[model samples]
Structures are given as C-alpha cells and as structure tokens.
Target: MDLLANLVLGFEAALTLQNLGYATLGVVLGTAIGVLPGLGPVPTIAMLLPLTYALPPESAVIMLAGIFYGSQYGGSTTSILVNIPGESSSVVTCLDGHKMARNGQAGLALATAALSSFFAGCVATVLLAAFAPTLASVAFKFGPAEYFSLMVLGLLGAVALAHGSVLHAICMILFGILLGLVGTDITSGGQRFTMGFSELFDGIEFVALAMGLFGLAEVISNAGRQDDRQLVTKKLSGLWPSRADLRRMTAPAVRGTALGSLLGLLPGGGATLSSFAAYALEKKVSKRPRDFGTGVLEGVAAPEAANNAAAQTSFIPMLTLGMPSNAVMALMIGALMLHNIQPGPQVITNNPQLFWGLVASMWIGNVILVVLNLPMIFVWVKMLSIPYRYLFPSIILISCVGVFSVTNDVFGVFLMAAFGAIGYILLRLDCEVAPMLLGFVLGQSLEAYFRRAMLISDGSLWVFVERPLSAAMLILAATIVMTFFIPTLTRKRTEVFREAE
Candidate 1:
C-alpha cells in the first residue's frame, strides 16, 4: 500500500508538463546520437553535462536517464539498416540484424529490436522500483568498514570484467587512483602532489577528465575513419511481427531480461556486457547454433532485450547505495553531486519525490522511445547519410564550450587538452580507459571510508575482518583477484573477449 501511494506521488510529479517535455527531448536527442555510428551515450552525456545545470534536479535526471536508455532503442536501428552499431551494446545486434536486413527483413529485424527493448525496459523498471528501497534499507546498516570493503570489491569487479588484459586494467586503475590523489589532502590541510600550482590544489576537474578521456579523445580517434555504409531500405514495411516470430522472441527475451537485471547490479556490468553475454547465451542454448549469425529472430530479440534491461537496472546501485556500477553511472553520480544531492540510502528517505519521480520518468521514457523509434525510423536513417567528418568538428566545439562553462577559466580548457592527448595515446595503446574513469570517480570515497573506519576502530585493522558483511566483501574481492592469477581463467577470459571482438 505504501508502495502504491509513493508510486501515485511519483506519477503526480513526473506527469507535469515540464518533466514530460524534458523526457521527450532527451529521448529524441538520445535516439539521434544513437543513430550516428561510432557515437555512444557516455561521451554525449559528458558533453551535455553542463546543460543540465539549467534544469531542476528532477528534470535534469529524468532527461539524462532518458538519454541513457533511449539510446539502446536507437542503436539497433543502425545495426540492422546500415550494419553499423551506434552504441557498443548494439554490437551483438549487428551479427543477426544486418543479415536480416540484407535478406530484405529489415523491418522485421527493427521491429523485433524495438518491441524486445520496450518489454525488457518495462520489466527492468518494475524490478528497480520494487527492489531499490529494499537494498537501500540494507545500506542503512552499513558502517564505514562495509563501505570500504564494498568499494574494494567494486574496483576489483571492474578489472575482472574489463575487455582486455587484466594487468593493463589494473595499471589503469592505479594510474586513475594516483591522479585522484594529486590534490590537497582533505584531512591534513596540506597538498600532496599539487606541484605549486594553485589550480592543482583543488584537484583535476571530473568534467574535464570525462571530456578529454571520452569526448575529445574519441573525436581524435574517429577522425580518420570513413562511414561506408549503404542502407538496406529507406522505407520499412511489415511493421508487425508474424505470430511465428513472436513465439521465437518470447523465451530469449525473457532469458535476456533476467540476465541483464542480475548482471546490471554488479560493478562494471552494464548494457554492453549484458548484450554480449545474452547473445552468447542464446547461441549456446540454441537447437542449431549455426543459425545465430544468419538472421535468426532470437539474435535480434535477446541482445536488444538484454542491453535495454541492463541500461535500466544498472541504476539500482547508484540510486540506492551511491556506488556506480559503470562509467555512465559514475557520471550520473557527478550530476547528482552538482545539485548538492548526495546519492545514497538517505536519498529515498530524504527525497522520496525525487527518487520516485525518477523511477516514474523511466517508465514514461520507454513508451516515448517505442513511439518515436517506429514512426521516425526514416528520419534516423537519413541522419546516417551525414559524413563522420562533419560531426567531429561540431562535437569538439560543443565539448570545449561545455568544459569552459564550468568555471569560466581557460585553465580548464588547457587541462582538457592535455587529457585529450593522453586519452588518444592510451587508445592507441589498446588500453580500456573505462576502469580508469571508475577508479578516479570512486577513489576519494574509498579513501574516505577506509580512513573513517580506521579512526573509529582506534587504529585496529581487525575491524574490517570482524564485521561479517565487510569480511564477506573482502573475501569476494580477494577471490576475484586470485582468479586472474590462475592460468585457466586468464586464458578463458582472453578467449571470451577475443570472441566478442
């Protein structure tokens, strides 16, 4: 009954004209971005972070949330039509989606993606609303020891699930933590690695790092690549699936949604990971696995469903525990901090309207995505005709302007440029920077929790081990690290990612 009442309050807040408008705008822009190959929501969201400042907190989050999930709907459109994945999560969709397009089933492939994503998204939202408060209640019982242990587990999970070499991922994590430690010491009132620069005293800007590492660096990397795509069809037909297709889609969609909802709660597990795993799972369980890359309906349904489900449920940890499960969630945490809202267990108790309103907004946004994607498919298809070269310059310009708007300081621009160069260099080295971004975002919080735990325990190290919750987290963290040391798991990890590639 309380849940029903809270949901009613949420609908009241989200149904306002202003909130609805922002949600619509966000889905529209998100779909546009997703239709453009080689563009993903992370950099786009980072580039637009400054714009959210003009909005009320509820509206700001609602729009941003819409963008993140709506992109999943847009991504599969290009994957089927042009054989290009607009988002990394759509990579698996390209396998079967493009084959279907080549066989003149483009409309069926696209409709499958849209319908699967919508169903998964609706289910994931329900799970989030029902489970978020329950998890947050557990958070209320946590001490600093548990928090610190939880962070350790999270950082380890990021490395474990990373794409390439675990050693390289660990190195990036360490580098990010070191970068995070470059500013003034909060407790000692003394600088650690400021190097006499007044700007360094405050620490590197999160927006600058995000822009440089993802936005500017991506533009540089994408500058030379040319889009050679030829659309399969401009006018889609056969809008509704046949009964046979629906029967084929049903089980895979359910399985994908379940995988996504569970994996989305783990650190570093997001849409990309969920989609790939779901596609692989479908292949593994198929009666004839050879049909997987040959325009099978299940292929389009499973991955699309998984990615959208993961995108929705990944918010659980960030909203309830203030622990980001991925890079995008880290940015969402930054957005909340900008509004002076500390995201954690107290977020529900202290700001029920904001929490419930955001939840309701997601449900509304999914419907908006389904409506926009099916009717406006041609508009998105035409957008693919724009050359990659034309988009890069505009993206670079927007990024610079957004970073400058932060503090009106030229120093921020210089800092961004430096990180951009560094980001490009790292990309060339084949290093995944997502783990680094996660480390930088969580470093300070992890340190703070650790120190507080130590202080409270009168300098006793056993406090962490004494608490069952913290001890279990640490044990899991240790187990994760140890798994990589084994040759079998290491080889298998390489094989899994290699197959993904």
Candidate 2:
C-alpha cells in the first residue's frame, strides 16, 4: 500500500510540465551526443553541470539521470552503423552489431538493440525502486568504522575490476587521494598542499578536474587522429523485427537484464562491465557459440539489454549509500552537493519526492527513448557524416565556457587546461582514469571516517576489526587484493620453473 502511494506521488512530481520538458530535452541531447563518436556520458554530464544550477533540484536530477541512461540507447547506433562505439559500454556491440549492419540486417539489428534496451530499462527501474529502500535500511545501521571499512571495500573492488595492471590502478588511486588532499584540512584548521594558491584552498574544482580529464582531454586526443569511420551507407529496411527474430532474442534479453541488474549493484560495476560480461556469458551458454562473432541477433540483443539494465541499476549505490559506483555517479554526487542535498540513506525519508520522482522519470525517459530513437535513426546516420574537425572545436568551446561559468573565474579555465594536459599524458600512458576519479570523490569522506573511528577507539587500530560488519568488509578487501597477487605469483613461478628446465 505504501509503495503504491509513494509511486503515485512520484508520478505526480514527474508528470509536471517542467519536469517532463527537461526529461525530454535531456534524452534528446543525450542521444545526439551518444550518436557522436568519442563523446560519452562522463564528459557530456561534466560539460553540462553548470546548466543544472538554474533549475530546481528535482528537475536537474531528472534531466541528468535521463542523459545517463539515454546515452545507452544511443550508443548502439554508432556501434552498429559505423563500427565505432559512441561510448565504452557499446564497444562489445560493435563485435556483432556492425557485422549485422554489413550483412544488410541493419534495421533488424537496430530494432533488436532498441527493444532489448527498453525491456532492460523497465526491469532495472523496477529493481531499483524495490531494492533501494531495503539497501538504505541496511546502510542506516553503519557506524563511522563500518562506513570507513565499506569505503575500503569499494575502492578495492574498483581496483580489482579495473582493466590493466592492478598495480597501476592502485598507483592512480593513491595519486588521486594525494590530489584530493591538496586543500585545507577539515579537522585541523590548517592548509596542507595549497602551494600558496587560494584556488587550492577549496581543493580542486571537481567540474574543472572532470571537464579537463574527460571532456578536454578527449578533444585533444581526437584532434590528432584522422577520421577513418566508414558509415553504413546501405539502405536500412523496415525497423520492426520479424516474429522469428523476436523469438530468438527474448531469452537472451531476459538473461542479460538479470545479469546486468545484479552486476550494476556492485561497487565499480556499470554498463561497460555488464555489457562485456553479458556478451561473454551468452557466448559461453549458446549452443551455436561459433556464430557469435558472425553477427548473431543474440549477440546484439544480450549486450544491448545488459548495458541499459546496468546503466539504470547503477544508481542504487549512489542513492542508497551515497557511494559512487562509477565516474558518472561521482559527478551525480557533485550535482547533488551543488543543490545542498546530501546523498545517502536519509534522502529517501527526507526527500521522498526527489528520490521517487527520479525513479518515475526513468520509466518515462525509457519510453521516450524508444519513441525518439526509432524514427531518428536516419537523422543520427546523417549526423555521422559531419566532419570531426567542426565537431571537436564546438565541443572544446562549450566545455571551456561551461567550466568558466562554474565560478565566472578564468582560473578555472586555466585549471581545466592544465588538467587536460595531465589527462592527455595519463591517456598516453594507458592509465584508467575511472578509479582515480572514484578515489578523489571518496577521499575526504574516507579520511573523515578514519579520523572519527580512531577518535572513538582512542587511537586503537583494532577498532576496524572489532566490529562485525567492519571486520567482514576489511576481510573482503584483503581477499580481493590477494586474488590479484596470487595469479601473478603462480605465473611467475611457472616461468621460473621453465627457465630452470
């Protein structure tokens, strides 16, 4: 009864003229950006963060959330049509989706991706609404020690899940924590690493950092690259799938949705991981596994559904426990803080309208995406013909303007440029920036929790293990760290034995 009443209230808030308009605009812009290669939700959201300042909190969040998931719907377009993924999550889609396009089943492929995404979005939204409240209840029981332990677990999970060397990920996370500490200490009234600049007093502006690392860095990197994208010029047939096609896709989509929704709830898990995992799972289970790389409909359906489901369910940790599971969610946290609202368990009880309204808006946005994406397929295909030279300049200009608008300070622009260079350097070195961003976002909170726990325990280091929940979290963290080292050790031992032989 209470759930029904709450959902009714959420609909009332979401159905307002202003909220609906913002949601529509967000989805439209999100799709447009998603159609453009090299532009993902991280940079898009970071560039547009200033735009949310003028709106009410509910409206702002609704629009931003729309952009997040709407990109999932649009990402498959470029993957299928151009053999280029518009976002990281769509990379796997290119494996089979573009092959389908090349084989003249482009329309069927697009229809499958869109419909599968819509179904997953609907399921994930329900899972979010059902699970978030229960998770919030569990989070309410956490103390400072437990919270600190949980953060440790989250950070470790990120490192474990990140691609590339675990050592490199750990180094990046440590660097981010160091960067996060470059301001006045919260507990002590003293400055730490300001280097005598007043701008450093407030710590680095997250907008500047994000826009630089993702938005500006992307522009600089792509500026040097030649455009080699081969657009699918083949005429697309009717958009609807045949009954046989639908029958083939239904089970894969369902399984993908279930996998994605579960994965999205994990720390550091989001659309990219879910999509990759789902594709792998499908290939493993399929009787015709050899057909996977040959443009099978199941390959398109499963990954598309998985990424969308993961995109929607990724909000759970951010909303329920105030833990950001990805770079995009970290940005969402910044947005919430900008509105003077602390994101956590209390958000459900204190800001029920905002919480439920955002959930309700997701359903509406998903429906809008299906309607908006199908007919506009031709339009997006046309957009792909636009030259990168013209598009990148506009993107860079907009990012500079947006960063400047944050505080109307030229220093922020300079900061963004500096970080942009650093970001480019990191990119060249093959460092993953996501974990760094997560560590930066969580650094202060982790420090505060650590300090509070120490105070409570009278400086005893045993306090973390003394509590049952905290002990379990720390144990999990240790286990994850060991898992990484164990495999490397085994490989090294085998190599040594071969050399001796």
Candidate 3:
C-alpha cells in the first residue's frame, strides 16, 4: 500500500513536461555516449554535474539517473555490433553477443538486449520503490565506527574484485589515498600535498581526475588501437525474437534479475559483478551448458539482464544510505550533497517528491529507452562504419575539452595526459584500474569516519571490535583474505566456476 501510494505520487511529479524533457535528453545523450567508444557514464556524469546546479533537484537527478541506465541499455548495442564493450558491465556480452552478430542474428541479439534490460529496469525500479525507505531506516543506525569499518571492507572487496594482481591494486589504492590528501586539510588548518602551487589550494577536482583517468585515458588507448578493427558487416533481420527464443530466455532473465538485484546492493562490484555471476549461474544451471559462448540466446540475455538490473538497484545505497559502491555512485553522492540534500533515511521522509520522482522517472526512462532503441539499431550499427582514425581523435579532443572545462586550467589537461600515460603503462603491465578508482573515491570518506570514530573512542582501536556490526564485517573481511590466500579453497572456487562450462 505504501509503495503504491508513492508510485502514484512519483508519477504525478515526473509527469511534468520539463522533467520529461530532461529524461529524454538524458537517455539520448547516454545512448550516444554508449555507442561511441571511450566514453562511459562516470566522466559523462562528471561533466554534466556542473550543469545540474541551475535545474530543479528532482529534474537534475532524474536526468542523471536516466543517463546511468541509458548507458547500460546502449552498451550492449556497441558490444554486439562491434567487439568493443562501451561499458565494463558489457564486457561479458562481447563474448556471446558479438558471436550472435557474426552469425547474422544481430537484430535478434540487439532485440534481446533491449527487451531484457527494459524488463530488468522495470522490476528493479519496483524493488527500489518498495525497499528504499526501509533500507534507509536501517542505514541510519550506523555510527561512525560502523561506517568506517564498512568502508574498510568496501575497499578490500574492491581490491579483491579487481582483475589483476592484488598487490598492484593495493598500491594503486594507496596512490589514490595520497591523491585524495592533496586538498586542503580541514582538520589541521594546513595545506597538504599542494606541491607549492596556488591552484592546489582548491585541491584536484574530482571531475578533472575522473575525466582524465577514465575519459582521456580511454581515448588515448583507443586511438592507439584504431588499426585493429573487429566489427560485424552482415545485414540483420527479425527485430523480434521467436517464441522458442523467448521460452529459452525467460528463466534466465528472471533468475538473473534476482541475482543481480541482490548483488547490486553490495558495496563493491555491483552491476559488473552481477553480470559475471549471472553468466556463471546460467551456464551452471542450463541443461546444455556446452552451448554457452556459441550464440545461445540465454548467454546473451542472462548477463545483459543481470547487469542492467544491478545498475538500477545500485542507486539504493547511494540515495538511501549515503554509501557509494563505486566511482559513479561517489559522483552521485557528491551531486546529492551539492544540492543540499542529505542522503539516508531522512531523505525519503524529508524529500518524498525527489525520492519518488526519481524512482518513477526510471520506469518511464526504460520505456522510452526500449522504444527509442528498436528504431535506432540501424543508426547505431551505422556508427560502426565510421573510420577509427577520425572517431578517436574527436574523442581525444572531447576528453581534453571536458577535462579543461572542469577546471579551466591547462594543468588539468597536463594531469590527464600524465594519467593517460600511466593508464597505458598499467594496461601493458596488467594492473587493475577499477580498484584504484574505487579507493580514490572512498579514501577521504574512510579517513573522515576513522578520525571521527577514534575521537569518540579516545583512540581505542578495539572499538571496531566492540561494536557487533563492525566486528562482524571485519571478521568477514578476514575470512575473505584467508580463503583467497589458502591454496586449496582458491583452487576449488576457480575450478567450480570453470566447471560451469
């Protein structure tokens, strides 16, 4: 009953002409960005953050939220049309989705992606409406010590989820922490890590850093790889799937949605993790597991559904609990705070329209997304025909413009170039960047909570253990470390995942 009433109210709020326009604009921009290589949600959102200051908070957030999920919707398009994945969550899609495209079923694969994502988004939106307030209530009880511990565990989980050497991830995290310290120190009344530059007083802008690291670095990397093109040249037919295809996909989509919604709430990995988990689950549970990676519709549907579902549910923690699971969430957190709106249980009660309106907008956005994508498939496919040389340079220019736009400083552009070089080096060396990005976002918040907890407990480190929740979290972190380091358990888990084939 409560959820029903909120949805009604949300519809009322989101139905406004202006808000609807923003939503449309957001989804369109998101789709375009997703179709273009080297652009993702984080930098795009970061670039747009400044513009939101002039709009109504509800409208601003609605637009931004649309961009997030809209990118998710568009990511599969690129992955299926080209071998390139526009978003990290779509990485697994390239495995089977591109194969399906190669087999001249590009239309069917795209249609599956569109429909599955729409269904997942709708289901997740309903879940968000139902549970956000209750979850927020639970989050409100967390004290500084508990929050600090949660962040510690979050950072650890991020490192564990990273694709490469844990040691390198840890080092990158430390570097992020150091970079985070460059700003003015509020506690000590002293400048830290300014390196004697006057502009350093304001600290390095998060927008600049994010755009540089992700947007610019990706552009440079893609530019270097232009000569190596892998795209599907076959014409496509049958925008709608056959009855048999639907029957096969239904179970996976449902199961994937459940798994994704649950995993999306976790502090790290979220959508990306959910996609991988869904792939593994479908492969394990399917009657013919050997059919995977060979253009099976379920192979394409499961991960696509799961990742999109997770992407929607990820808003729960950021909006209701003030806890950010990833860099994108961190940016959203910053945006919410910038609007003078505090995230957590209080938000639902104090700002019902903003809460419910955002929820409502997601459903509407998904509907629009499905309708828009079906007709735009040909357009997106045509995008693949553009020469990589021309497209990549424009992307690099856009990235530099975005970086400079954030700070209006040439130094920020220089910083981006430096990070691009570093990113290229890390790529060659097989180092993980996601963990570093996660650490950079959480470092300051972790430090702030840690200091606050210490102040409250008179510098007693045991306070973390004394608190039941914090203690449990610490124990879980320790367990993960122990399990991963133990040769036997690590081998077993790895073998289990591999056996799903």
Candidate closest to the true structure, highest TM-score: 1
TM accuracy, model 1: 0.98
Q: Give me the displacement of residue 239 in model 3, in angstroms.
A: 1.1
Q: Put down candidate 2 lDDT per residue, 1-501, tens digits, no spaces.
A: 888888899999999999999999988888888888878899899888877878899999999999999899889999999988988888889989999988898999999999999999999999988989999999999999999999989998888777666777898888888888879999987998889999889898888898898888888888876778777755888599999999999999999999999888888888988898899899999999999978999999998999999999989999999998888998999888878888899999999999999999999999999998999898988888787899888878888898888868999999999989988898889787888888888888899999999999999989999999999999999998888778775465344323222
- Candidate 2, which ten residues in sequence have the lowest lDDT sum? 492-501
Ranking by lDDT: 1, 2, 3
Q: Model 3, 1-501: lDDT tens per residue? A: 888898899999899999999998988888877776667887688667756766899998999888888988888988888878877778778888989998888989999988888889999998998888888888789988888888777777766665655677778888887787787886886898898887778666666666666666666666656544456855778889999988877888898889988888887667777888999899999899998888889988888889889988989987886767676777776567658786667888999999999999999999999999998877876765666678656656776776676568888878777777777777668776666666776677788888899999999999999999999989888876666687886566555434322
Q: Give the higher-TM-score candidate: 1 or 3.
A: 1
* Overall lDDT per candidate, in order of appearance: 0.90, 0.89, 0.80
Deviating ranges (above 4 Å) for candidate 3: 227-234, 337-343, 396-418, 488-501
In angstroms, what RMSD does candidate 1 have relative to the true structure? 1.1
Q: Lowest summed-lDDT stretch of 10 residues in model 3?
A: 492-501
In terms of lDDT, model 1 sits at 0.90
